[model samples]
Target: MLHLGLGSFHRAHQAVYLHRLIASGDERWVLAGGNLRPDMADTLTALAGQGGRYTLETVTPDGTRDYEWITSIRHVLPYEPSLAGLIDVGADPRTRIISFTVTEGGYYLDGRNRLDLSNAELASDLDGRTQQTVYGGVAAILRERMRRDAGPVSLLNCDNLRHNGERFRAGLLEFLERRDEPGLLDWVAAHTTCPNGMVDRITPRPSPDVAERVRLVTGRHDAVPVMGESFIQWVIEDDFCAGRPAWETVGVQMVASVQPYEEAKIRILNGTHSCIAWAGTLAGCHFIHEGLSVPAIRRMAMDYVTDDVIPCLHSPESPSPIDLAAYRDTVLARFGNAAIRDTNQRVAMDGYSKIPGFIAPTVRERLAAGQPIAGVARLPALFLAFLQRWHRDELPYAYQDQGMDPAAARAICASADPVAALCADPVLWHELAGDARLTAAVRGAFDEVHTTFAGALHG
Candidate 1:
């Protein structure tokens, strides 16, 4: 197996599952992981130096912690601008599956799931100027595999994207089309499969304290130690073109279609996670636990799930009816985990993406059904306030976003009707901008936030 974007989540989630399989005497699948971006060079170096071994720290809500050595990643490839090593790994016949976790925004697709060729990095990649973007890197790898006839392969996307596999395939094929490589596109269609997947774990960045804890528990210096909540879940579409590990044996839910599980997770867990992040940041809180600890913030999140999302998702005749209330309570309990210091800044970084990806789905659904959106609109309202504060450089810590346009965002924040200006952003609100119901709901939510949350954040 070849894994890209070897970040904290990959180590804490997928690697841990594979580790379990390995411990149970299944060694057919091991991991070859590396970063596609340069920011994780330090982590790559540390993992490579340690022969792809790292300590995992799992924390319970009540502060109980456990440590384990995760050694499933047998190969740690170094990063390169050309992505030569990654391409080689992709082309290797023994590597039947190449999985990725490029976050929600890294696919470089617009809201319509079309390739955003206008992005400069993407433009360069498509023009053969670089092979850095996921599109660019994947295309290059596929070409080599086709040339060498590396046989059928599976591309598992373990991210929070809705119908991730289908969307990723669309963008990838479009990228190949732009490359004028009809042959490679056809080859991929005949030779590859992209399985939709949903992965969840509250993995925070490895703090210095985590490293120190690793040292105390284990007689080793683990610079790349990863910490997460004890709870984790992975649901994948069982459509591997080549073959896949017995992931089910290790508790992976291999389903025929992961849509039900994916939608429920995106709306309940991911959407509420964003709610906590934005609310937590606005409330001058350092961590997700602190945010969820706020009674009002926590209740708002629960209401979003119980009142808005649950109704949309729970259906009697459907194949899978969700226990959304149970999921909401479980998510709140996870967020309130003090030992897992999931940061507001980390969770809050991608509001632009989250607004559309996680929150807006519920907003759009509720508006069409003439249902109460007061609980749902809070996500975008909190985000708009968060964005305005970001415009004023008022965020407590440094942050970046794929959807940020500093000048335009600042202008909107300073407009006579900042909330309206924000609501009308074609990229974020989509067609909902003209809807009277949405506009009013969002504005009311924003005002109510100030009335209710201003003190907690300011104090």
Candidate 2:
């Protein structure tokens, strides 16, 4: 199999599953890692250096640990000038599925729910010179496969975005259309399969300390040993352009449709994470699992989910997709795992683009149903206020790197007034403000957070 964006998530989630499959003696599928980002060079080199073997440490519930050795990937491929070979491989009948873990921003869409043609990075990518965007490169590869009459292949997206595979298809098609790639678009629409998927695993970032600790534990040096929660879940659509592995054996639920699972995950797991991360960071807390360890903060989180979020779920009739009691317990346990010191900043980054798309939809649903998002409503509003402060250079802590530049954030937030500025951008504020109740709740909550946080800092 060909895996795009071979980052920590892929190694911790998909690779582990594939490793289990390989241990059970399935050898047809092996990952070929590719990246358009130069930053991945070190990580790619480290894995390639290790001979595609790494330790997977499962942070257990009772504070115990279990380790497993994974060898699911066989090779790594650098993003070369010409992606012809990559296309040829995907087109080859032997390849069954090609997966991706490209983050939410990688898709680059504007507020209009249309492809962002104006994206400077995206424009640069289509020039066919530098590998800039994932969509452009993916389109180039897909087009080549069509030209060569490459057989069917399923494209699976493991990202947190809603209808991720569909978004990938749209993004690729948009690129193809803008470039006028001829019948390639039609062929992709008709032949290629884009399977919507839901993947959940708490794979925390590995720092030098983590790497050192892992080495001490395993008695072997690992440059990128992945730290994650013991719990893992994967829900996938049964549709595949080429065939698929018996992933069911490895805890993959092959469903007739993945829409419900996607919605459930987005609204529950991802949405909650975004909320906690954004709000927690502003409140001087870092790391999601850490948020659960504190009583007041954990209470806020629980209230946000149960009192505010649960009422707004898709099917009030159906049982909640996640085991609420178990999830709360697991979250607290995961946070307490000192091995997985998942930074709050890591979760809090890119809030300008991440929050609305991930959690606002659920917040909107709750509002539409005339439900009071008492605990949940404040999250987005507070996030916006936090974004405002972040942009305005008013944050308590210092952020030196480029991930979420307070300066840029300030510029965006300061571009216009709060309600007007946010409401103007559909991507940021439309849904949340559409409901009169939510608008007021968010506005009031934003003010409350500002007041509360300000008092905590100054008083």
Candidate 3:
């Protein structure tokens, strides 16, 4: 197996699953992928020095901890600006599955799910000037595999993006089309399969506390140590071009379709996670559990899913994909796991992504059905107020968002009707824009949160 974006989440989630499989004596698959950028040079070098072995610190809700040595990633190639190592792995006949976790913004998809060729990195890839973006490097590698007749491979996307596999496949094919390589494209069409999956693990960014704990317990100065909550979930589609490991035996929910699982996760877990992040920031909390501790915040999220999202998803005629009530309760409990110390800043980093991807789908569905959208609109309204705070330089921490325009966001917040201005963003609302009902719903939610959190700040 070849995995891209060997970051903290992969180490704490997918690698853990692979490690479990290895423990079960299935050692056929091993991970070999490297960072495309030089920013992670030190960390990548440390992991390679350690032979791709790292300590995983798992913390439970009750503060109990377990440390395990994760060795599923047997090879960590050197970092290259061109991602030549990654491309080589893609071309290798033995590599049956090439997976990636390039974050939500890395896919370069427009609202229509087409490749945004105008992006600087994408433009560079289209012009064949840089081979770094996951798609660019994958295209190059797929071409080499076709030339060598390297046989079939599966492309597993373990990111949070909804319909990730299909979207990525679309972007990659569009990318390949730019080169006019008809034969390679045809080979790609025949040889590669993209499987959509949903991954869940509360992996906070690596910090000094985790590294220090690892050293104190294990008496080893191991770098690349990752930490996550005790709970973990991975739901994958069982579509593979080549044979795959018995992941189902190892607790992977190998199902026929990933849509139901993906939808539930995005709307409930991810959506509420963002709600708490923004609301907690306003309430002057640092960690996610701290925010979730506030009864009103937690209740708001639960009610949103129970009263708004699940009803829209579950119908009288069809079976519900998940136990919505149980899932909602479990999600809150997981968020309240203080040992994980999931930060509001981390959860809030990609509001521009979450607002649309995680939160908007429920709103859109409710609006289309002529049902009440008031419950779902709170998530976006919280984000708008959060964005306003960031625009005014009031946020306590550094904020980063690849999908947001700082200047435009600030202007929107500064306008006479900031809430309305924010609602009209084409990047986020898209076709749903210009609807008076949504604007009013968002305004109501904005005032609701404002009276709660903003009042607390003033008090």
Candidate 4:
């Protein structure tokens, strides 16, 4: 296994799952971790110091907490020679699968959903000098594999993006299409399998208090102990490049197609996070737990789910019919977990990429059905307002421990002229602005919520 972007979430979720598999005598797979970004150097250093062993801590229902020592990762490799080094890593015949939790924006695809070769960051990397974008690295690797006739390797994408595997393949193909190689893209299309996957694990960054708690549990001081809720679910499309681990033995739902599950989760679980994160932050709540404690905010979130999200799900025809109430309760319990310390800012980060999958799909579906998106409409508008506030330097950036810079955030936020950003970014505004009614609804809700939320926060 070659795991890219070895961050806290990946460590606590997929890596931990593999660790559990290895612990239970499935030691055939070991992770050779790679870090693309610079901050992860410290994380790599920490994990390497401990021989790639780290603690995954979780909060329990009865106020007790527990920790597990995860040791599935074997080695760390920095991108020393940019694309060349990454190609070398991927060219290894023994590495049958490459998994990524590199986040949504990490792919560096442009608005047309093609490889953003024009991107300055991407152009620097593709020049093969010393730059290293995920696309550049993956493209370079695929080119080498095509050259060396290396056996197949699956590309497992564990992010929340819809049709992730298809997107990864498309992004890669877009890059390859620019090259003059004969039968290379065809060979890749025939060999490489990019599996769409739904990965859910509430791995929140641990606070200093939680760090001390880690010391009490493991007797070893861990600088970065990932605190997650006990709940986890992975639904994956049943496809592999060379082959795959017996992930089904553990708990993954390996299906012929993960589309239905992916659609359901992207709209419900991820959408709910967006709904609360912005409104929660604007309300001056420090974390999701704190937000849930607020009656109005909590009520709004529940209403949004029940009135808006639940009706859209493809439930079973059985008598049970998938109890949405039960699911919502579970979500509430997870969000309201005080010990988990899931921050609004952590959830609120990456609104640019997150909105298209989580919120926009529902809005688009509703518009197609000629249904008003009142309950659904408010959250997006509130999020936009939050973005404006986050931009204007009015709010202190939450979840700083997890790669959120207030200055950079402010700049991104400042770039968001709701009218301009939406019109320009099709991933967000194309479908949204196309619906005049929805756009009006969003603008109206934005005005009302912004006033109410701002007044409430300031008061």
* Higher-TM-score candidate of 2 and 4: 2
Q: Which residue pairs in candidate 3 collide?
A: none
| Model 1 lDDT-worst window of ten | 315-324
Off by over 4 Å in 2: 81-85, 127-129, 314-329, 394-420, 431-436, 455-459
Off by over 4 Å in 4: 79-86, 110-112, 116-118, 129-131, 181-183, 315-322, 398-427, 454-459
Itemize residue pairs with steric clashes in candidate 1: none
Q: Is 2 or 3 the stronger prediction by TM-score?
A: 3
Query: lDDT of candidate 3 vs native?
Result: 0.86
* True-structure lDDT of candidate 4: 0.73
**lDDT, residue 96, model 3:** 96
- CA lDDT, every prediction? 0.87, 0.70, 0.86, 0.73
- Model 2, 95-145: lDDT tens digits are 668787877777787655567765667778766555557786667667667
- How much does each candidate deviate from the true structure in C-alpha RMSD? 1.6, 3.0, 1.6, 3.6
